[model samples]
Target: MAGGAIAVAAVGVGWLLWPSPSGRTLPPARARVYTEFSACLLSDSSGVSGKAAAPVWAGMQEASATTAGKVSFLAVAGPESESNARLYLNALVARRCDLILAAGTAEVAAVRARAPALGSTTFVVVGTGSSAGNLTVLPVAPPAGVSAAIRDVVVAASERTSPH
Candidate 1:
């Protein structure tokens, strides 16, 4: 019985230390994936929209490098104008993107309007509403380290609103 117990303990430890099936000490960071063959990136003229897309594309690129597939990008003008929004969305649909990265409130609204026809495509929005399907909303607020900046803005707004 003691010998059997020792054997079992050795087996458990061996399993715990075993490398993954790929024979690597660490698992791969990214997996190969398939989608609708294009990614539509919508950003506003203020450039915040483009900034928001950077991290996502970087992560995807890293994954593609480590895995067995490729990723593509298609960017469109996402200015505050409704006309620009319509043009951007139409172009994205024409490109047949499987994912849409909407960078602002206006872009989110425009994409939500056509999401039904988008048909299971994924939509990621930065700083926008929450009602659209397959839409993941990442809200942006002032960071904790920027409390002083926020206070300054509030004071400025109050001064403007208070009087002559």
Candidate 2:
């Protein structure tokens, strides 16, 4: 009986002191590259029309030009409606864009629906109230100063999450 007790006590202590499985350790995540190899910009005509579209397109052009590699911009020219927005988004995905900049809630929602299959692409939404699976939101307000504010916010956020 004494030997049996000793054996039980030894088994209990061994179990208590056992190390956790090394395989359970999480692998480090890969570093994300913010640089764009190819990009597509999609916006509703109502959100970006007439004089308003010119400045928005100009801003995008300037930003793309500043990047290290060449960037292409494709404006989804069609009727300003939710259905058209979805079509534009689908076309953007078909183009195999590395990054997509969509403007407005409907467009963002459309992009979100396709994000599961389009996981490799990054979507940046401006002035939108919708969320995508892997989409990054960068809200921009009008008149001029807001662009600078959004730029600063994006830079700060990128720096915080970027792998050193």
Candidate 3:
């Protein structure tokens, strides 16, 4: 794994549900459990299928597996605009996502715009984005490096929010 970076914005700052051998897994489907921390994604209209977003999503799933965390995503609706992006971001915020991931240019921009006021809910912009306040930006890592880059972010968030 190579080519990874984590920058704090403004000089600051899952998918499967399967029980691991040590019980640190979230089942992909049936019989889900509260993972204590949830990381949600705000992707472009292309959603998970987009090339840029897929690796990030995969990294997120890897993190979920390691942290026993929950992962979910919402694809932005058509007509890419900040206003529309905000709606999706608001929905994720409303869901009380412990960490909100913004992948894709549009999604990252939306996160940057709203992150300052959101407070406490960590924002991760995975790609070419600027880090500020509560937002953290990660490089568009290569396929081999996604897991390592994402593992740190997700695990840290999980530990910070987890009660047990």
Which structure among the candidates has the greatest lDDT? Answer: 3
Model 1 Cα shift for residue 26 (angstroms): 33
Q: List the residue pairs that clash in candidate 2.
A: none
Rank by TM-score (best first)? 3, 2, 1
Name the regions of candidate 3 deviating beyond 4 angstroms: 1-30
Worst lDDT window (10 residues) for model 2? 149-158
CA error at residue 5 for candidate 1, angstroms: 86
Q: What lDDT does candidate 3 reach at residue 8?
A: 30
Winner on TM-score (1 vs 2): 2
Candidate 1 displacement at residue 121 in angstroms:
2.6
| Per-residue alpha-carbon lDDT of candidate 1 for residues 1-164, written as tens digits (9 for 90 to 100) | 99999999999999998878977676577755542234455655543325555554454444334332234554545347656676777776676555566655566677766676676666665564674566655555433312232223223323333334
Residue pair clashes in candidate 1: none
Instruction: Report model 1's TM-score to 2 decimal places.
Output: 0.48
Candidate 2 lDDT tens digits, 1-164 = 99999999999999877876774644788753455355566765554443333344445554444443223445556666557777888887788766676655556556666666777767766554565576776555673543443334334333433345
For all candidates in order, the CA lDDT equals 0.54, 0.57, 0.82
How much is the lDDT of residue 89 in candidate 3? 95
lDDT of 3 by residue, 44-150 (tens): 98988887678778888888878789999999988788888998999999999999988777778889889999987999887675787889988876865765777
Q: Which one wins on TM-score?
A: 3
True-vs-predicted CA distance for residue 10, candidate 2, Å: 99
The RMSD (Cα, Å) of candidate 1 is: 16.5
